[model samples]
Target chain A: MAALDRSLLVVIVDVNPAMWTAEAAGEHAPFVPIIRHLCMFINAFRALDGGNRLAIVACHAGKPTMLIRADEELDRSLHTVLDTALVLVLLATPDDPAQYNSVMNCIFAAQRAAIMIDCFAIRTSSTFMQQAAHMTGGVYVEPTAQQELGLAQLLITLALPDRACRALLRQPKAHDVDFRAACFLTNQLLDRAYVCSVCLSIFHHGDIIECPACRSRFPPPPRLARKRAKRAVAPAHGGPVIGGAHAAAAGAGSSAPRPAL
Target chain B: MADGRDARDARVSPLITFLVGQRRGRLGRLYANPWTCEAVVRALPPVARHYALRLVALGDTGDGATFAPATLEGWSLAHDAHQAALQWLLDLSIIERAEQPGALRLNAAFREQCGSLLCGLRPPAPKPPNKHTPSADELDAHAAAQWDALLYCVIHPSEWSDSTGYDMPAALLEPAGLIAARRVRARADGDDDDGDGGDDVDDDDGAETIEVWAMSKRGATFVLQDLSAQAWHILQVYIGDDERKLAFLLELAHMDFGHGYELRDEHRPLIAELHHLGIVHVRDAAKSKSFYPTRLAAAIVSSGDISPGGSARGRAIVESNLRVYVYTSSRAWTAILALFLRLRTLLPNAVVASITRERIQRAMREHGLSAEAIIAFLTRNAHEQVRRRPAEERDKALTVFEQIRLWERELERFTAKEAYYLSDFDTLALFDAELAHALASGTHLWHRREPGNARLCKLVLHEREDVIAEARARIKEFKRSAGLA
Candidate 1:
């Protein structure tokens, strides 16, 4: 018999009030139903193994905080329990730009820990969340409105297995990953961008004399050269298209990049 | 006590054996206590614990209808895990077949307690005063000291005799069969013939034999196991057939580490037992004082992790050349290492030892230590040097580990069993009939010759008692009918 594989699962919930209220008015239910489904999924995960642990983190507009830290709630004092996390489940919609840094910090931490960050985009597709999931070798699924009833099923079928079980079972793959980067200054997704050499921060426009992030001053682009570069890169519709063809089709009307502030 | 078979079967975990021996009524009463229920749930194997949790959750949701056999079969895809979980639950009397066919139900009291636990409705015990509460480190120190003293009493009784001013619970040790009072003295001048090196025998002559204490084989095995496992084994030995002590120990297993619980009147004797076993430490021992559960007590029912105190001090640096460096000055630990390793040198803070085939075999054949237990001990106590090694380099020690296991397996290769070798029948037909009966009953071990023209057969162990008896009765009838009675 194989040895028992202990695992820790971190469930990150996007408790955005406005999105849930809008969904509550629509066909999708409010936070209560979603929470119920999440609770069922958590119980299922816990049932996988006696040593398996579950932690719940809620992301509000201000800062992401751990709603239920497994170590504290279960009173686990073992060092093994504290050292590693196996999976991170993010139930999210479109998030506020202010929480970008904090959410990214969580993603990078999970990445460094070798944790799979499974993203379940409930209402709207989050490009940042997709990137996080893709980079971490986790499954990213944005279920349509008709498939909302199968949220719990999706969690069990797609994200329940640990790395060991994933070795034998066929895993869900993210077909089209949005590689678009958000401008550090405006926190806006940019289709065509210029990156700062020192800090590697992306910018929406390259006309500035000094880099906004690192203040690395460079000679301004020649006026005639800037116009030629703009005409060469601009699409026929004069609109910035983010992501690949699949993403553009899924987010047809919402594909326009936010104007630079 | 009966034979080697009984002794070998006794190697199963004492906790499981004790739980299996419990009566349904006693088990129900034990489970009625929330603490005992929680401990039992936590002590179950991983698969069994998951099954219990799922059942408890179902009970909370009032889903009794789904517990039918047909529906429950879909619970897990792994058939082995499902079967093992069900068997364990049945053995512990946690669940039983219902009056209706194809249905199962949890014991009423167990179901209620488990439901309460899952729903987080268990009422917390009254809080003790914050003052005088011990820190985690202090508790660890007390636990380690108390445990070491107990082990010293068993492993090195000579050293135990030199220590004074501390109660050693010698009487408890005697009853647990861990230590026995014996006589020891230096060899006399006139009796100097060398025969065998009997370590426990008194070699003195024409003089009074000084009484001393020595450990038994069971005591040797006890010292080598981890602290939590040792506590359980000791409790099983001390409790014997008493169900109340088992219940109390289970309740103690549920107590939170580093927290003080009120010392009720009924808890006095149990607390004293735990104190003697080094599972808990009482501050004042007064009637109304509170008792703190040490790391040992709290971790007794934990499935995977050992106590924090032991984990910190269990570091043993093992080299590929079979040399070992244990970083501790504790006498109890040294005594344990001496059982399976050739001690070379003892420094102020470390002890150097080497693993040898003879020592390992002696531990397995004489002391009843299993290969799995030894492997688990070494793996748990692996030092930082070994732990930090790259994955490819870690396989270097695998050869040594395999050798130790092979030595142990060699000792267990031949097992003697009690069986009846049947022969000498007047007719071949009678022998054939008897052999057929034995085979049909599933008690046939082997046959010396074919039943066609010979009359030799052997029957070994049977799963049920009635199978052998029924076969014997059938053989007697056949003999009478053949006029051979």
Candidate 2:
């Protein structure tokens, strides 16, 4: 088993109302079924002796909060969710007003909290997942399917053992992980984006390529466009802004605010 | 103690504190207070944190070496070697060699310390024992008595056996002011009540049993439980370093004092039980001639191969070797150190005195001091300031690569200064041949041909006297063959 197998895992679920509602509409894993699967997986993890531990966080739109099952409720908690079978249908029904309200409250709170957190646009969004997995020694997987619980099975087979035991067995290769991350500003994935050299905030389009945090403009790579601008702009220092990619972007018609760290 | 104080005053970085504490078992205590090593602390070295965390995890075991090295290597301890960790535990008196070499054994003191710490951090497993469950109060009392008895034995193990006529003072035991057990005689005045005549006296047979005042099993068990894991560890480590103390501890195991009523040492039964707990080592005492302190004893008190010499603990022990050289300075070390204070030499930090074999043996034979007790005194106070080069430099200073080169260079210079035989050779070819031969024979330094002679070349080296002798002999041989001498 790899060290990850022996390490304690902490899962922070994005329980944002808007996000989960979108996911429930078949865009991602539906909230009720996803949660049911998560609870079962957590139970399975907790069953491990000596080396395994699990904790959960429900990240609502407004507030990211712990969803730690009460120690006393552990036996009934996960099992109850698992036994429900058609949990999504029950949760989606309009009859149970209280459950719907409580679930919505949790989702809104998590989303609000998550948005308030420092947001940064990422050209390649792999860092976020990589960091979470690295920190807790758990695999980070965001599933597109709400109906299937494939991730849980993957965890059971691959990520359950400790690093030591993992060394002896075949492990899921690091390369297999999707390294892409969604941009903080637009929440869209970008291929190549401008970044603040100081705070390393990525941007799609902005007036200044210079880092606002440090007031240091990124030196643009030399090119035909920059050379032409250099002659036309008269080098902004004692005259006009120098011909550079940053200067050109500032002059361009694109109107997107740069992302902040 | 000075080193510890200095570190505190310096406000040593948390990493350093952790490292120092790692050697001394202080970090384990700190972590017990719910002070977690925060992830964001910039001062903390990632590498050090990794090792410290692994050590803490390993310490959680019922036995100190609970996890194998291979198991740990996969975890956060990917960088460290198994031997390096084993060595540290050995230094801390947490792990040691079993009866056989290469086999790992856990010291009881380490087990208790780790167990309690881990238990405190995380609640104990909810599973109840399969055996009879005692009330909470009963458990507490049992633990207390066991600790107390162990402490008593640590302070005085001889009281467990009768072979040694001397009885250790009860006050020496921690949780002070306990009384020692001794046989009391029936009062002669009792004769006045029952005897009809001076020659005739009738007594109840039960008086013999009532005459002896001894510690009860419950009391012994409580005493052992009361002892702090640290102190118990010190005693465990102390006994192993010295041959005599080890034998005494083994003897306690053989006598089955735990089962019998006659207490030899007030703490003997407790120590004997500790041996079974794997804190101390005692082989089949009933059949064996004597017992020896396990690796646990040597590790807790003494500073040797456990941590490297340059490490804090090793350095401390090395420095303290002068006035009083204790193999260990544990409580046991202090007790032994006090036994042979020829004269007090007080330094600002450490106390110095000479604890001799004769003095220790005397304490054993006359004072009924158990071998483990004496070794503890030695280990706890071993001189920490031996005047030696640092461990790193000692080996690096004369590394094979540099030493050999330097020696060759020095010899070359000495040969250059002495003008020996090379000045006599007339031809460069002859000179080169002669120089090669001399160099091969380990004789020549520098050679240059002179304008006159045919057989020899101008040679320079520091030691001219020896070179001249050899040159003359060569010349003579040449003359005999060529008739040119």
Each prediction's whole-model lDDT (CA): 0.64, 0.36
Cα lDDT tens digits for candidate 2, B114-155: 333333333212322323333334433333333333444543
Off by over 4 Å in 2: A1-10, A18-56, A66-127, A130-138, A142-170, A176-188, A194-201, A205-223, A226-261, B1-148, B154-353, B360-485
Q: What TM-score does chain B of candidate 2 reach?
A: 0.26
By summed lDDT, the worst window of 10 consecutive residues in model 2 chain B runs over: B34-43
Which candidate has the top score in DockQ?
1
TM-score of each: 0.60, 0.32
The candidate scoring highest on lDDT is 1
RMSD of each: 11.5, 22.0
| Regions more than 4 Å wrong, model 1 | A1-261, B1-25, B45-47, B122-131, B157-172, B180-196, B199-213, B238-256, B305-311, B315-325, B337-345, B352-382, B386-485
DockQ of each: 0.09, 0.03
Task: Give the per-residue lDDT of model 1 (tens digit) for B28-126.
Answer: 777777666666765565456556655665554445733675444465565555566577787788877788876888777877776555434433473
Shift in Å, residue B285, candidate 2:
31
lDDT for residue B418 in candidate 2, whole number 0-100: 38
